[model samples]
Target: MSRSHIRHELSKLESCLRKEIGELANKHQIKLESKQSSLCEIIEVLTQAKLCDEPLFCRLTKLDAAFCQLDIGLYGLCADCENEIEPERLAWDMLEQRCAECAENYEHQHRQELRLNH
Candidate 1:
């Protein structure tokens, strides 16, 4: 898909997620201060406050970062290798940061680290 199209999709998704979060925050009587807040700030506040579940917050965090990356012309590039990310992976999740090779290597290394720590 074109970058514009991808951005549009990401915007829609981010809006939806933000609305959901707003509703939950309202339910909990918490103010978002959205006008003054960045996505990272909002995430930090909500996370520290424990106002939302991990899964929801996690998704929003990814969306926020991905949206920012898009703005910076860095979207769809692997974070580690700086190569273009696979279409299949982006199709699965636009928030994906690592290409398949880097992802597999990261996982392998992480598992090794876990073993070492254990």
Candidate 2:
């Protein structure tokens, strides 16, 4: 997908999240600090209240980070290796911008570290 397409999709995701989160909070009588909260604020509230599970929280976190990187023309670059992220990963999860090799290595490293600690 094109950068424009990814940008548009990210924007749409932000809007969708805002709308759904707002509705959920209203329905539950949750008190958000801001009536017109920011994307970060929404994330914070969602996290604080445990309104969503790990996968959704992870997705939202990735989306938020992607938006931050997009502003500086770094949206689809691998965070670990400074390479273009694989198209397959991008297609599967628009916010997963890590190249396959680096991602695999990173995961392996983390797993090894966990094993050593445990």
Candidate 3:
């Protein structure tokens, strides 16, 4: 795929993520202010919000980095192996920084580490 096309996709992803983050933040704030629930219930809500917000924030950060890389003509290349990421995967998620193989390996290692830590 062309660099222009990739840039366009990344832009769309960034816009979508920003909108989602905004909505999530707004919903969390509204829930916190309007809900009159038990402390446990409030904590549960907060925990759920945190779980959703954290990942969105992470994706936003990654999208920002991808924009920077796109500006520098480095987008679509895997961070670990420096291979061009598959077009289909890029279409699915422009923020992904690893090729399929590297991503699988990274996820495997991460899971192993999580198990060991547990």
In model 3, where is the ten-residue run with the lowest total lDDT?
33-42
- Candidate 2: regions farther than 4 A off: 19-30, 33-35, 50-53, 116-118
- Could you give the C-alpha RMSD of every candidate to the true structure, in order shown? 3.1, 3.3, 8.4
Instruction: Give the per-residue lDDT of model 2 (tens digit) for 1-118.
Output: 6678878999888777666666777776878743487778878888788866745557768888998888888988999898999878888888886899998998999899999999
- Residues 1-118 of candidate 3: C-alpha lDDT, one tens digit per residue: 7778877887677666556655665866735421334324433454666653577656765776787788898888999999999988877877888999999999999999999999
Q: Put down candidate 1 lDDT per residue, 1-118, tens digits, no spaces.
A: 8879989999788777777777767777877865456788879878878855657787888888788788899999999999999999999988898899999999999999999999
Per-residue lDDT for 29 in model 2?
Answer: 82
> TM-score of every model?
0.75, 0.73, 0.70
Candidate 1: segments with Cα more than 4 A from true spot: 26-29, 33-37, 50-53, 110-118
lDDT of every predicted structure (CA atoms): 0.84, 0.80, 0.71
Backbone clash pairs for candidate 3 read none
TM-score of model 3 vs. true structure: 0.70
Model 2, C-alpha of 12: deviation from truth (Å): 2.1
- The best candidate by TM-score is 1
Ranking by lDDT: 1, 2, 3
